[model samples]
Target: MPLLVTDYSWTQTDSTVYINVPLKGAKVGKVDILSTDEYVKVHFPPYLFEAFLFEPVDDDKSTAKVGNGVVLISLPKRTNKEWDHLMISTNDKEKKKVIRQQALLKYQDKLTSESRSKAEKKHAEKKYALETMMKLEKEERDTIQKMKDTEREKTTAELAAWQLNQKQKAEVETRVKLQRQRSRQTQIKAVTEEQENQCSGEGNVCKSEANCKKKQVVLPAPRLTGNIQVTFTPRVFPTALRESRVQEEEEWLKKQAEARHAVNADTEELKDLKEEHRNPDWLKDKGDKYFATGDYLSAVNAYNLAVRLNRKIPALYSNRAACHLKLGNFHKAIEDSSQALDLLTPPVAANAAARARASVRRGSAFCQLQLYAEGLQDYHAALKIEPHNIALQADIEKIRDIIQGTTADPDTQ
Candidate 1:
């Protein structure tokens, strides 16, 4: 049997009752409290306190606070009257047992109801989040469809205009050709008539015919020929010739051209795209615009198309890696960044910035995946390219601190 708490204090007003029970250094966490209109119980391990009120009090309006080595309970009276005692003076054990069972049952039912309410609230929140995601997906689809339709309309209009212009040009050229033919025929006939009249008037048919024939057979002037200087524009990469590897650049260009031509325009996604939209450069710009606007999914879509059009472009893969990073697709980001780094070869000045960016993006993805050692290597590579970058230096220091177990929060980056 537990020790009974008897040295408790109580005070009352016309409508309220306040009870104070000393905890004897008991922790708040270890205290179990239960209350009802007719009964109250406080259980603390080896000590127990029970109160059976003399008159009914409103449990619904009651409050409890546990602090400073005490448990304080405030109970409101059901009727506007003073309670003569904190507990009822009773000797019947069966009556006390019956009240305690009833209070326990009520408490269990209240707990069940509260738990059900919390579950319903959590379920509602999940449903709302799912619905919001679906709505956003629908909106994105609608926007992409609108863009496709607009591009299709514009391409159609341009094709129609070009066809009409070509037709008009052909008509003009046909008319000019016909006029020149007619003028030449008329001139030949007039010259022939003049020659015949001259032959008849001279009464020397043979001589006149010979003269006319001689004039017609007169040799054309000898063609003037001179040396014609020919010059060819040097085919080279965008970088300065002195600083560039011509062979590698040429090979890179050849690969890019092949990649651009390799796109299967007959595919469902590409078949309906405008000619301009099929260009990797245009798609890259589109992706950049979407990224700037915080539409990472759309940006990824655009970059995907660009990569399909020309897989050799490092910037396309690098930029798409950024979109994947923002979307939290860390693995995909790492893949794209690695591909970009692979394409940014020769380690020249022209590609130094691109290589640095690819390295940093890959490092960020690796760090996000908790591959700190691999991430550190990539960060170091990027820092080498931009040694004076303070932000990059700071990031390197943070990563080092994380690796050394000196960082309080590894997830700070």
Candidate 2:
């Protein structure tokens, strides 16, 4: 039972009544006030104040203000007359109980209505946000498609122009060749006529024939052949030959080249895929979208296709490992994480984050498999790459506690 508060004061006018209820150091947020035409109540945890109005007032026009550890309420009188007392001079328990019950029911109904309105508003907001996101995505896709179409049209026009130019060039070359052949034939005919006239005029057929034979086209001499030596700048590592790990660099280069051209186009699974679906990067993006939507199986399929298209992409393996982890395929997750780590070798600044992520994922898989030692090693490796990660540090401490038998088994909780 709450203590009844009698230390309240009130003032009245012909048209309004004002009541002030002391909070006794209670927080304003914790104070509850309920007002009606004939009754007013203030509840502050262990303290309660109630007033049965001497005469009915207009509750709709009443207002309450809480400040300075007190609540002040202004009530408008319905009859426009001064009240002799603020509360009714009666102690009828049954009437008080009925009024209290009515007030409680009215408060409960108001709370229910307000909560329903809030829930509806929240739902509407979420729906609008989702619709807006989808619209933006659609617009972006349409823009990309428009760009692709424009590029395709430009390329087609260029190709047609090139083909027409080539055809005209070929025709001109053919005409020039025919004209050269005719000029050579005319020169041969003139030479033959001159030889015949000389023979007839000299009346020496054998001599003339011998002279014509000597005059027959004299060919130029063949040019002397000689070797032309060529040399090229040496292709070597930036570091000195002695200081460089040539073997490792060569292996890395070889792996890079293989990765770039390793698409398995002849596979049965890929034979019926659409052109866009054939792209490894596109598949990876599709996988990411599926993962974001919580469709783990679809995400796995997308990642699987991307991996099959290009096994060298570390991100594909890493993302697939995440999906596997979500699906509770711990062994598969470890395998994918290991593959991602392998592909991210010869660690550089560009891949530092990737390496850390792969290590953490693999470590998680190890821990899930109950291999605490292995997990600890991978976690330590990740920490070395990302020492400033607070979450990672916390996780490491937890794992350590578990390993030392200082905490209960995680599975049990």
Candidate 3:
């Protein structure tokens, strides 16, 4: 007879193979399955599935159960060993069937035979029982050994992970401490340079810290004209005494003007006559370009324009907050980040990343401002959104360290 073709799905465990095949509208009696130690064949009307076993199975223990719209075949392996694959191939179906039948007959005949002596039968039974008990004991020992091995592997993995975490934490703490020390040294160096610049080339050297802080032009109180004090330009003050102060004030004003001008220029460009330039996305991109180039002032300008154009956009505020953070405008950074947070609604999937970034930025600004309590709160909130962010965790630890250090410092309170 010719073999029928069928489509099926199968899965295997340690000792059993399960095959499921579609057999809609077919009765259970119509489904026939033949099993052998080395092969299995299934027949259901127009469909047939056959495969050479990857290993031997106990044919008598195999079963086929049909229900709903499917036929399920369960094959029991003769030994407790695992099969490497489901089957070797789809060949030798006829030859394997003949061999399986002969084996089945021999097994049945052995079961029914009465020619053996009573002594021999008792010995055979006892031998079978002893083998069964040894097999059970071996399986129990194997199970216990496997359980111990798994637990040991688990402990080793956990230890490795803990060691990695500890190493990373130590590195982060060292880096943060070095950064703090460097920042302090830089501040001291800047102050020394400024003092040197103020005192350089002057014939009258400041003899003490009090003199250095005192006004060089210690003029008498200005004369009042009808109860209104007259205000004169720095030029009216003594030239030798006022020159440095006047120049410093002028330079400071000029820098402020340049910064304001740059912002105004960026906003004006974003708001140009071209309609395309007014788009929020275009303005945001422009801001990003400025930020990338380290022009945070101009970036802030662009982001301001973008926010004005689309106040509802959360990203505009978040990006603006980042620029503010870079520019050391902590107050503005906090304000913009708060705006971003307000715009970012709950069920964070919609803008989780944006919300997280905004939180980190706000937290950093708070940390810079010495508001560790608030900064720690923001960091914790950000962590809820990205629990596995190593950098965020490091920041949280740094903030906690700051809090602890501040609490311990006598000067801080």
Candidate 4:
């Protein structure tokens, strides 16, 4: 039998020996095995100062080495407990089934990993396509908007020119009319004065043909007769069309603002949902933030959803209980603290500390329900176990003060 030289232990229940050994470090740095029905040989590389097993049964294979001074020891698999656990009894009692199971599990894991990778690739492709398409769409929209702006600018210039021309034409027509009126007035005044002068020469105006003829002196030149023409100017140019275009542009701007705001809000909502749904801690943080903000109802909702995914938490239940207390739900506070006490198993020191906290919190809840005696007992028990706990000491002092006043009889007063 091989000498058990390593740190290993064996327990004999009846005649069979059960051995538990750690195969780690350089011992497992290399492994090779070959087996027949009666025996198995395990080879190990050197730098392996000591190889551990429950105990190797064959003495001859001990210290056997390859050319590089590595041990090639063989042991009977029947004697190894872990190996035995891995073994299955049948007409062909062998550990082949465990190997097969492990292989199948590994293959399934690989398949699942491959499937996830494919899904991720597909999503990446889709996202890339969506981004590209969005870029193109934005470019197209910008181009169209530019064209519209250009058209609007061109129309505005045309309207301005038309208005300017109309004003100039109006001014010219006014000037011409003024000149004609002045000339006519001047001619009438001259004729009237001349007639008056001629009439005054005889102390009265003569109506006789010979007197009229004497008064009507011959003009130096005969007045030319000409046809007078008139032109009408339009009051406005591109009148109704330009006004309608401007109104349309204003409407389009309003529509664009509304659309952009809606899209931005939707994108923000989507981003929040994605980040929250993927990680549970994010939701918990949000709940804590809400609680900090004094929005107890919103905090309750957020914490409740986070707890649904993972219930193995002490802080979640404790904080939720705090929220319940603030909301005046004493029964809910008791229930949550109770659940927290049941679920949490912290490290020894942490567990002890948490025990005192839970006990004190429950005691407060009990006191709110007027279970004063039980509440006081729980507080005393916590203080006794953790004597130096300052917070507990404070609570105990407050309770003592309350009791000192309450215990005084009315008759004493």
Candidate 5:
């Protein structure tokens, strides 16, 4: 016996690698596909096809499906790189072993038959064995597939029956609920009419009114007028006027004390405020240092100080936006980026660069927040500023694919 090799074809694109192998008489459970980051192997009977790629692939994203007399393998590339070649090497080593096993299984019984001579018996046995094996393999595959189909049909029928029963139950419950509601309304109307008839007589009233009147008590009117007069003397005064004058003096004293305390507190605060550093450049430098050290919170504080001192500096807002973006504060990043864009005086080279950086950071934050449309708009704006950046282009493409349910192939796009 000799080794056998089955011919196959493959194609590659920027994001995917596709391989199609013909399986004319293949059976389920007889075909196996093994894949890793660097290699792919397909084992089917006497054929064993292996491929070693030039670079790694995303094995988790790859898939293989057997249908239409073909095994189609789709490999998603880990990175957007072109494949120089399909496979590095191939091997087929199990041909003789498989043939010997089949021959022994099929011809062992025929070897003991007595009607025919050895040569003629051997020839007939070989032909019958091959045909019988093929037939058995086909029948086994058909039986397995038939069982799967039957199970699927059973599950579908059960689901449909369950849905129909739920619908009917809901309809019955709805009807019962409507009937109960109508019965309750009729009962209420009858009770209301009986109450009206009972209350129709001059001496009759509702029990609620009787209870309400029972809980209320009438109060008597005052007999004397509410009047009082006060006069001030040198040492003595009316009782009411003296008490009122004392209360006014105490309130004035308390307010004077509070005002003095507040003035003292303001004086101390003013001293601290006068001593506090107010240089915008120094604050921006402190923020830059904090950002470089990955202290985003501290950097944000420093940037806030700088912005308070000088609101016209666009770099302060853009730099702070980066820190906010890193900290997962997407709303703050958008606000800061919008501020940077607003503060830009004109579209000079430096201003354009700053705008592009702000836009990219804002776009990335928007994507993290799942606001794809706004993210796309910011990304397009960034692209216009830095049109030749490959990384930005790839990001735009990936974002588009994500928005489209991961179906848009980068190469095709």
Candidate 6:
């Protein structure tokens, strides 16, 4: 977030940063815009290159600025967790191209059944999208039309409720106006009554007892009395405009949802196209050969390219995870292992054994970060799958001993 030297208003509670970017909303995809006191990094998916640039302008406030704070950076997405392998992917574009070309050549002749299947699926999708677009032309598919009846019902209910609120508010205002008018009229009437009482009741001075004094005569003072009615012209309620706005907002939401469906359809089509190019099984043997030759970086690359080609095999992820661990990229190692674990099956069997192996490797990395508790959890989980594995058994005992020794007794502390 940027500083507000003058004044600023923030309505959202979610963590947000104020960017004075020249473009308003060009940011996209799943990414975090992280900033420290001295620097900022925009992490992006592996395939996308940065396209946006920010420049600050001197506004009416006239704050003088310093030299160029320009930063040019490219964020890369790690598709199958290849982050920690040191120089795994060459920084030099030409070298990277060579390595990538070599990697492709290493497996170019062997397209698996899965690879062909993905390509077929992608072609079908493209065909379908084109055919649909041609047919629709300007007439987009109303995917939200299926929800028309429901949406109509919901909108109707909202409109009705809003109308009722308007009517109620009108009634309240009308009643208040009438009541106030009545009160004013009543006050006038009361004043008149008091004056009339003062004038007509015991308010006279006897001149004399009619000179011969058998009867007394009184002279009356002026008395005022009358009916009073207060009336006011009708005022605009402002409710009709408000109700119209509410209905408009609901309609806008419906339109936005429809737009989302259209975008989602296109997104899925593009996803299929990308998947066709990333079938993992196609490069499995090639990656395995690299693994065998102790070329961990190449093995990681082969696995990555294979994963991009196909993702149905958990074993490939696990194998790539092993290479990542060897290269000190624990984040990537953990990610691949976690994914493999999710795909692994047959709980407590061979599948669990594979998953347990991954767990141990990830746990070892966790221990390196001094995350003993998380490390212990992974180790314990792994033990559940392979209770009698000699290596894991020793790891657990050592960790337990370390934890106990390092944790001081509460009384002593």
Which model scores highest in TM-score?
Answer: 1
Model 4 is weakest, by summed lDDT over 10 consecutive residues, at 43-52
lDDT of 2 by residue, 293-318 (tens): 99999999999888877889999999
Per-residue alpha-carbon lDDT of candidate 5 for residues 225-308, written as tens digits (9 for 90 to 100): 776888756443222234536876678779999999998886665456433447778888989999999999999998997786
lDDT of 4 by residue, 24-131 (tens): 343443433322222223323221122222333432232333333233333434343444322234433344334433433443354456667998999999999999
Candidate 5 has a TM-score of 0.34
* Stronger candidate by TM-score (1 vs 2): 1
- Candidate 2 C-alpha error for residue 238, in Å: 34
Per-residue lDDT tens digits of candidate 1, residues 92-172? 999987887687667655655676798899999999999999999999779767767877889899999999999999999
TM-score of candidate 1 on Cα atoms, chains taken together: 0.47
Model 6, 159-242: lDDT tens digits are 999999999999999999899779877876776566555445585644543332332223356689999899966433322234
6 in model 5: Cα distance from truth in Å?
A: 35
Q: Give lDDT for model 5.
A: 0.74
- Alpha-carbon runs more than 4 Å astray in model 4: 1-275, 384-386, 400-413
Better of 4 and 6 by lDDT: 4
Q: Which 10 residues in a row give candidate 2 its minimum summed lDDT?
A: 236-245
Taking the tens digit of each residue's C-alpha lDDT, what string does model 3 give over 1-413? 32344567788887787778777566777565555567566655545566667877876788887789787878887777777777775467687566555544443343334334565889899999999999999997797678678778998999999999999999999999899779877876776677776676467565677755653323246567666678955543222334547776678779999999999987777665588667889989998999999999999888877776779998889998898888889999999999999999874597888889999999889888876667877888899999999999987766654443312212233
Candidates in order: C-alpha RMSD to true structure? 23.3, 20.8, 36.9, 23.0, 33.3, 29.8
- Local lDDT at 409 for model 6: 20
Residue ranges of candidate 6 with Cα displaced over 4 Å? 1-279, 346-348, 406-413
Which structure is stronger by TM-score: 2 or 5? 2
